[model samples]
Target: MLLAAALLAAAALLARGLARIEGELARAAAAGNRPARVEFVVPEGSSARRGVPPRLAELGGGRALLGTPEGELVVLRRDPTSGELELERVYRLERDPERHLRREGAPLHGWFLTDVERERRTALREAWERYQSALAQALEDFGASLPTAEEAAAEVARRGGADRLLALTGPEASALQRRTAAIGLARAGYAGALPALLVLLRDHQRNAGFFARLCALTEELSGLALDPARPAEALAEAEAWLRAHPVRDPYARKGAASAGPVSPPR
Candidate 1:
């Protein structure tokens, strides 16, 4: 009788360990996908659902539920158009288990400065100053010989200068350089610079301040002699990119919120 009891206990423990391992595997697979949508729910005094999408559903082998270390629920899914897995929505599991079970990935939070708080502020400050200096130099070089507005605009179009400006800087310095270059190009009436400027605007990992700068540059550029219809389309593309790949600084949790479904490319 004692032997039987021990065996039973051992079996139960094995089963529990297997279950835990399975749950972790499921979460890992889901996190790997980083889907556009996810839903989650938190039960009272328990872990919240991390929200995995259905595309990752296969990994769970039809088991619809998983738990986080904190006991949060998770669901996963695949995008219909791209067939890419994403987390769609999330909710509190205790309040509505059924709904939470069905929830998908939510709009992920953007990266904030707080996420990188441990970094030396002085280092970051110095880096930023250096970036500004490089940007200033690029702008000056690009516009150096043009004596008149028309000549400057013509020069920007002929040089394919935005690419050159971007090449001159590192990723850390690219944002400032891009923005300044865009402004300079726009001021000179360089409609050709719009495509490259648009690319920078759509980048997800760029800091919020940089996005604001892009917006300002876009507005300034839009006022130029270029075709007015294109800027709207350009802005829309940038917004779409942001929604699909929401930027988050690993160190900072703050990032730009999605503006919602982008208008289909016209």
Candidate 2:
């Protein structure tokens, strides 16, 4: 009798676990199915069980569901207020190497709802787009190779390019863009903008020699004294440059790679 009772108890525990899994699956489908830990893109109004694109996973499939190596699903939908597609939800999945969900396998084979990292790249996308658009506009306005190209480019700067680049250098920008903006400013003869690049390091405790090698790179472009020694003066120069001119893509210069070779400060 005791042996029979123990077997019954085991079966009861298994049934409860399966029920919990079923509930979780229902929730995942309703929430928009996708694995939370894996970085995958899912379109709005699609079923995760069907299949979705995986960044670097070998695709696998089972009788019940499609799977990636990591096992999960993602969903994206347009925000009504913003009218932009945002990452709507992510669902969990069993780490099945087969890369497919097995519905017949009962409750253990599919998605769960647990992830903390916000799955969205909207801000990064927008930032990169704006930077590219501005560069393109500036280059178009400058129209390289004209006999008076310098004058034209300088005029574009005064109209607004210079001030715009400086504006992007503010703390509001991501470190990547800020570095690019500062380098552009330096190449445009605004040595003062080098200061903006320095601040991105986020390490106030670093000594002088370390900073000089870093800023030394841009010092070549501006032709002005970029002494990290006197930050007050550098800032003043930056402000003055900001007031006077904007950014221009000096494509006339030989060997200018898109945004120049400026790396972000470490």
Top candidate when judged by lDDT against the true structure: 2
Q: Looking at model 1, which ten-residue stretch has the lowest summed lDDT?
A: 257-266
| Best candidate, TM-score | 2
Q: Report, for all candidates in order, the number of backbone clashes.
A: 51, 15
* Global local distance difference test of model 1: 0.39
Residue 53 CA displacement from its true place in model 2, Å:
64
TM-score of 2: 0.25
Every model's TM-score: 0.22, 0.25
State model 2's lDDT: 0.43
Expressed as tens digits, the lDDT of each residue in 158-261 for candidate 1 is 34333443342345554544444444454333433445556755662234444555555444433322222344554685555445433231111111112111
lDDT of each: 0.39, 0.43
